[model samples]
Target: MTFSRVNAARGLTLAALLLAASGCGAKNTPADASRAEPDPLAKLQPAQDMAAYRAMSDLLYKLDQEAIQRELTETGQEKSTKPAKDKLFGFDATRAVHDRDFIASGEGKALADSLLTYQTPSGGWSKRTNMSTPRKPGQQFGTEKDYVPTFDNYATTTQFWVMANACNAHQDSRYCDSASRALSLILLAQYPNGGWPQSFPLRGKYHDDITFNDDAIANLLKVVGAAAEGDERLAFLSDGLKAQAKHSLVRALDMLVATQVEVDGEPTIWGAQHDDETLEPTSARAFEPVALATSESADLVLFLMTLKNPPENIRKAIDSANRWFEKHQIHGLRYRRGDELPALIPDDDADPLWARFYDIESDRPVFGDRDGQVYFELEKISAERRAGYGWYTERPYKALKEYRKWQQ
Candidate 1:
């Protein structure tokens, strides 16, 4: 039977016991955790577009989350204790934490407990907090007075999925309750214009922008879209939540359509960030310019494609953006990093890669560095930044694939 309902009390108890028996209980004190050193991976910070790791940001997380689910069905075991070669987002990356098939196992219950420990009053999680790491045996995770919930760096997005998975692994009210709180947090964070800020309860600066950079808006839509669609993963959500999700998604869709950057009054793609009110392209980090963001807009297009029956305007939006991606695609270039510098080298056999940004006016590919200088030539940026950032990605191909399938 599908673990759709949130009635996992029996499962919860059983799982709780199993967790304790398995030495995964919440007994370790905060002092025990305090002594533990941070994982070395947590220290690896990118110089630019830290949240905009192209192949990652959201795609890799989405894929790897599914990959773990697929593996559980085949192997019927918990994830490997060994490290995953695959990249991760936020602090979970440091742990290579796989969202395993834990419904029947108590693993899901224990995991949900971990999530609950970290959840804030806003009903969401803060970014870069470890999701895979269990708190020391007895200490709560989010008791640190400063744990503010956010949508940045896969914050609320990751929580929703983890809770949803826990609910599915076994009916757990806490899991569903946490997820519902997250849903409300997400819903409340929306601007009237259908855009989402990077953080909720409103922090200043880029936090308030209509963010597509790092796929924050896209991830919000993914969960809200799932609930609106009455997806089984979120079957426990009430009809009211579903309706709220639907209405929110409908409004957000309009926001997306309205936010597309236009040239000559013809819709093109979108920018990484947009003004919350005016909806015009806005600058995010200095390296991220107010331009047609091929990456973010592409993900947004893919999100639109996921809708079952899109309105004409949405289909048109997808079509227009597809045209932009196809037009701006870079050929004969491959990015390869080595111990030596000059990471991106030309390869005659290289497949196509899309530039991260485009000049909204000139319609030419543009690159930027930490010093806030935008360059036309790929080689102009310093080597440290050139290697640290994702100036290119394979995301556009998904839009093309989805578009072709939609046509069919």
Candidate 2:
């Protein structure tokens, strides 16, 4: 099907399914009619805009429900599968292709070949898929419901790295061809302003936003930067591709500097995501609010510091972000992870910690819950979030340590 046609069909299907499930247009009994509950799908009215619709937590829950219902309808039983022996295809798998001998080995060849089968027409791999198993005919490229080719969770960039290394070791034209296609996706997905969306083909909502979450754009920059600098892993790239990579690298760096949040005309850190057009800090998941994100900002600063002889603007951006880190560092408290619940314990000699999110104007730490409520204290959130999320981090210390060396 044509892309546009497919999207339109998906919109119709989802809306029909969700509306029916939500009791929209359904006959109401006298008792039901008297009880007056708000429509559950009210937040999902803009279903035509896939990005916006997908960003709503309610819609996501509904999508999962639909998937389960479809599975039960088709098979009349719950689908069961064996647990994986080791980690499936993910960032770790991408990092595992480092040894040249391994890339040339028989096992490595098999893994690389499997990756080729999984590559979508968009020239990117999907996240959390099992590339160990070859793609079945007519199987969807993405394993996740409603997810297409994305850069999120170190997807395409990592696949490209594997392909490039495999090409280098095997001297295989097919590997080189695959690497080139992946490079094209990276180039095509970049916004005119030099930022990258979490997903390509413009999946709507925060996925359409220029994302720094989980080092999304940073990973893209690394791939292109290597290609531009003639890194041996990507040595198969043509002169034309290299030139394009160089241009992409320049634009991406410019976007990074431009997106740094400024409060009262003084530069600070950045949010995990930014609007593609406005470049303003934006929210992503329900628990992720529009605020200065310390972990992502720290990773960004570390990447920037790697550049040799940066311009004045880049230097200034780094310095200001470092100051913000220093000023906001939490003292006399250490975050302790417990079996039941995590807690912030008071300890005078505790290493400085940084909150995951901070108020843009006040610089005070903030917390978010699944209900979309913002809290000033970590204890105020749900137990699941407190136990599952990294509410406090020492990541800024690494950046600060690197910055000191960079200054010297």
User: TM-score: which candidate is best?
Assistant: 2
Tell me how far candidate 1 lies from the true structure as C-alpha RMSD in angstroms. 13.9
Model 1: per-residue Cα lDDT over 1-408, one tens digit each? 233223233334433433332231122232221112221211111112212222112221232233334334445655422221113322442121244544345655655666665554335666545545553322223322122456766666877887777766667676666687678768756775677877655556876788888888888999999999988888988787788889889989999889988899989998988997789989877777778877777788888888988999998999998987887777788877567664567888877788878888888778888889999877898887777777778688678777888778
**Candidate 2 on 221-310: residue-level lDDT in tens?**
788877877787787777777888888888888998899998999999999999988899999889999999998899889888887667
Candidate 2 — which residues are off by over 4 angstroms? Answer: 1-95, 346-350
Candidate with best lDDT: 2
Worst 10 residues of 2 by lDDT: 26-35
**Which residue pairs clash in candidate 1?**
8-171, 26-137, 26-138, 27-137, 27-138, 28-137, 28-138, 103-169
Q: What overall lDDT, based on C-alpha atoms, would model 2 receive against the true structure?
A: 0.73
Give each model's whole-structure lDDT.
0.65, 0.73
lDDT at 367, model 1: 82
Instruction: Tell how far residue 303 is off in model 1, in angstroms.
Output: 1.4
> Which RMSD does model 2 reach against the true structure?
12.8
